[model samples]
Target: MLGIGIVGLGYWGPNLVRNFSAAAEAEVRCVADRDAARLQKIHSLYPAVDLLSEATEVFQRSDIDAVVLATPINTHFPLAKMALEAGKHVLVEKPLATSRAEVLELMEIADRKGLQLMVDHTFLYTGAVQKIKSLVDSGELGELQYFDSTRINLGLFNPNWSVIWDLAVHDLSIFDYISSGKKPVAVSATGISHTQMGIEDIAYISLFFNDSTIAHITSSWISPVKIRKTMIGGSKKMVIYDDVEPTEKIKIYDSGFSVSSPEDMHRWLVDYRFGDIAIPKIAQTEALLGVAQDFVSAIVRGTRPISDRESGLNVVTILEAAQQSVKQRGQTVSLV
Candidate 1:
């Protein structure tokens, strides 16, 4: 069994503890949090696991082979670097780091140490997304056309990062995974702050790809109601992914339009094909568990995971460009 240590039991840490506790090929040996109540709460569930007050203690443990970080956005780079320097495999929560330089440095460390460096992009492990990847790769959704997404929820604002960093990362990871060969070349974004923190609470991002493909993401922390929906449109079919829907998360619509022969150059006929909507069944499994399993397996088997450092780089690249675009008042930012 691979021994694991977790740091930061804030918003998303407890969930990681729960999943890693139940995950395959791994065991939570130690966990640390500055919040005494958080440590006590986790101790209540896991009496056998060691609890520490300082995060540095997690890296000092001799038995722990891997470290999982759920710290704030700014602390990811330093904590992960410390773990890697101590010869421990590391898993960090999304975006990898605040800037590309930090991520590249962490990648360099992990490479030198020959350790697994993974990002906890939990959405990439979801059954619905995995199914969507299959559909996309199988040519079920003909030539890719567009990816439009809206991920908005209420009242979970962060002082460190804006809505674009907090929310759009998910959609970008999903897009990067599903659209294999097609990558965005440029990005444009706009956002506004609604609180005294001067952090953006709402944003809109548009991505331009080399081909005819494009993507638009609307992310907000001010929505009255929660919405996790995405549409992947192609020439032959379209997909509707409603993450909030428990049962019918993925619905494939076999409907699209086609161009008819043009008798006159200016007057071309159009035909619309409306076919049946197919709802493919998705396995009901917690995505975090898959993340835990992949982390452990990659460490043991010496294989790069699905959410590897390279994929994490892709997500971070777009995030950096998008944030710059927002700062420039929706000026298009070149990614390449």
Candidate 2:
């Protein structure tokens, strides 16, 4: 089994530990956190696993084959860089790094060391997203025209990053994965800081593609109700994925309209077509477990993971552009 060390014991860290421990091809050998209480808790639960207050021990240990980082956004680059430089494969949480340059630097080190660098864009491994990818690839949803997403919740704000970096990164990664390598030409974004921390609590972002395909992401930390929803429209069919639903989370609508020119001048004809809606049954599985397995497989088999470094870079590029646009008061930023 591949020995794994996890850094960070906060919010998402525990989940990573659980999933990596349950992975058949990997073992959790050590955990590190700044909080002594958190380390004590981990020790109580996993006494055999080593615990450290400083993460340097994890990078120094020869027994660890890989390191998984679930720390703050700002700490990602340095920690991942240290792990890669230590001749160990690294898996980090979403967005990879704050800037494209940081991501590129990490990529260079991993490439030079022949180590696997994977990002934990966990939603890409979900049944709903996988099904959407299959349909889009199969042309069932012919020529995807738009992707709209709304992810909002109350009071999970971070001190280091804005709401877009916190929430919309998920949708951005999803858009990047299901789009199958389609690159956007430009981006426009607007946001506001409602709290004293000076970080955005609400934001909206729009992306433009070369083919005129568009994507919009709405994220907020001020919503009274939590919602996780996305809509994908294509030439032939459309999909509605509601993650909050208990069952039948994926619904496809065979509905569309078409327009044609008329014989008379200044006149046109339009037709609307409505067909039966189909709800596809999605296979239920733990997405984090899938992420852990993929990371292990990438390390062992020398295969690229679904959420590889390039995909993470793609998401970061868009995010960087979006942040610039936000700073310019919603000015459109060209990605070209």
TM-score, candidate number 2: 0.98
lDDT of 1 by residue, 99-201 (tens): 8889999999999999999999999899999999999999999988999999998978999899988999999999988986356889999999988998999
Tens-digit lDDT string for candidate 2 (1-336): 899999999989999988998998889999999999988888888888998888789999999999999999999999999999989899999879999999999999998999999999999999999999999999999999999999998989887799988899999999999998788899999999987888988999999988859999999999999999999999999999999998888999998877797788678877887888999988799999999999999999987799999899999999999999998989999988
- Runs in model 1 deviating more than 4 A are 261-265
Q: Ten residues in a row with the worst lDDT in model 1?
A: 176-185
How many residue pairs clash (N, CA or C atoms closer than 3 angstroms) in each of the candidate models, in the order given? 0, 0
Runs in model 2 lying further than 4 Å from the true structure: 262-265
Q: In candidate 1, how many Å is residue 279 off?
A: 0.7
